[model samples]
Target: MGPLDRIEELIAYVEAAKAVPMSRACRVDRGELIAMLEELQAELPADIRRSEVMLAERDKIISAGEKEAERIIAEGEGEHARLVSQHEITVSAEHEASRIIGEAREEAQRLRDEVDEYVDTTLANFEQFLQRAVSGVERGRDKMHALREIGTFNPPEQEESEEKPLPQF
Candidate 1:
């Protein structure tokens, strides 16, 4: 029989026992009660051992779950750190690229200004040289006209003493 049934039987036995007159004491067979107690004791250890085993299994499962939770939290933290680092690197790279582009534009503008200055200086010098050449040509033309008007422009005649004879081939 189960422990509960044995306990009920013990309760019945005590209730049917003889009561002493005017006292809270009762008379029962000691040998029979001892035998019943021995049976209960024999049944108790197997049930207690099963309960202990179940409690141990529950503790093991709880420990494993806690360990898994810790691992997942650590992995999440590592991923967060890596993403933050990548974002910082991207932001730094963007700023550096902007700085480089700004410097390149400034340098390009400076070069353009230098080229324009050189071109303007060269054109001015060429204009001055052309003006001087035209002025010299005009002066020569004026001298020729003056000589013609003064009748001093003459065609030279070759004298016989100064002429050279042609060579016969």
Candidate 2:
């Protein structure tokens, strides 16, 4: 029987013993009690050893579980850090892109303004040139009309030996 069963038998044996006439004691067989006690003593060490082995196994299981938990926590923290770093990089990149785009837009607008101003100035200069040309042509016609009225509308013929070039506007 196990130690507990043996202990229960010992209790029963003590309870079933005859009571003394005037004392609060009982009449238990000494030999029987001693034998039971010896048996209990013999079984205790083996039981204690088994309990110790179970406790060691429990400790090993707990240690492994604690190590696994620590590893998982560390891995999770690393992943979180990586994700945060990636997010920061993305935010920085977006801001940089926005700044670059803004600068490019401003540059494009400046170039367009410069081109418009150049075209306007060029057109104004061309208009002035055209006006001067028209004035020259009108003055030449007036001179011709006056000459015709005075009866001297003849254009001079150039001699082949001393040819002269016509006047240029």
Candidate 3:
């Protein structure tokens, strides 16, 4: 299950557990609780890794777009130079070169604009996803903290089970 789901499940488990007599703590199956916690721990790192991969991909895409834009601009400049040199050094030839250069610049600008728009849109969507993911994690964290502060569970008085150390982040 997802991190949010795991958090909700944990909350539900806590809510459904029996409350200890004369105490705020509930009696949850230690093994089950530990399992749920392990699941949650596993899920969180995957989400973080996914976000990191996406950010890296976003950077690569933006870089590629920029390189493509520069290459187009350079090609345009080269074409302009070639056209100018091929014709006799006349006013019309210079004018044609100027026109070519202008068109090249306009085309390059248009391409850059397109790339920018695409990158912005993509990044915006990714940002929204990341925001939602972060918010969900934060909410889960708050809930966990609240549960901890309240001391969610206490062992039964009659039966003492060996407590195992939980894995640390």
- Please identify model 2 stretches exceeding 4 Å from their true place: 15-29, 88-169
Give candidate 3 misplaced runs (Cα > 4 Å): 86-169
Best by lDDT: 3
lDDT, candidate 1, residue 50?
A: 55
Q: Output the number of the TM-score-best candidate.
A: 3
Residue-by-residue lDDT tens digits, candidate 3, 73-166 = 5765666677677656555656765676576567656766776676677667667765665675575456555557557455568876789999
Put down candidate 2 lDDT per residue, 73-106, tens digits, no spaces. Answer: 5554555555556865756555554555555455
Give one clash count per candidate, in the order shown.
Answer: 0, 0, 0
Q: After superposition, how far is residue 64 of candidate 1 from its true place, in Å?
A: 1.3
Summing lDDT over every window of 10 consecutive residues in candidate 3, give the lowest-scoring window: 140-149
Alpha-carbon lDDT, every model: 0.57, 0.58, 0.67
lDDT of 1 by residue, 40-149 (tens): 66876765565556556555655555565555545545544555568657655555545555554555455556555655565566556445544544543453344344
Model 2 whole-model lDDT (C-alpha atoms): 0.58
Error of 3 at 149 (Å): 9.8
TM-score of candidate 2 relative to the true fold: 0.39
How far in Å is the alpha carbon of 121 misplaced in model 3?
Answer: 9.0
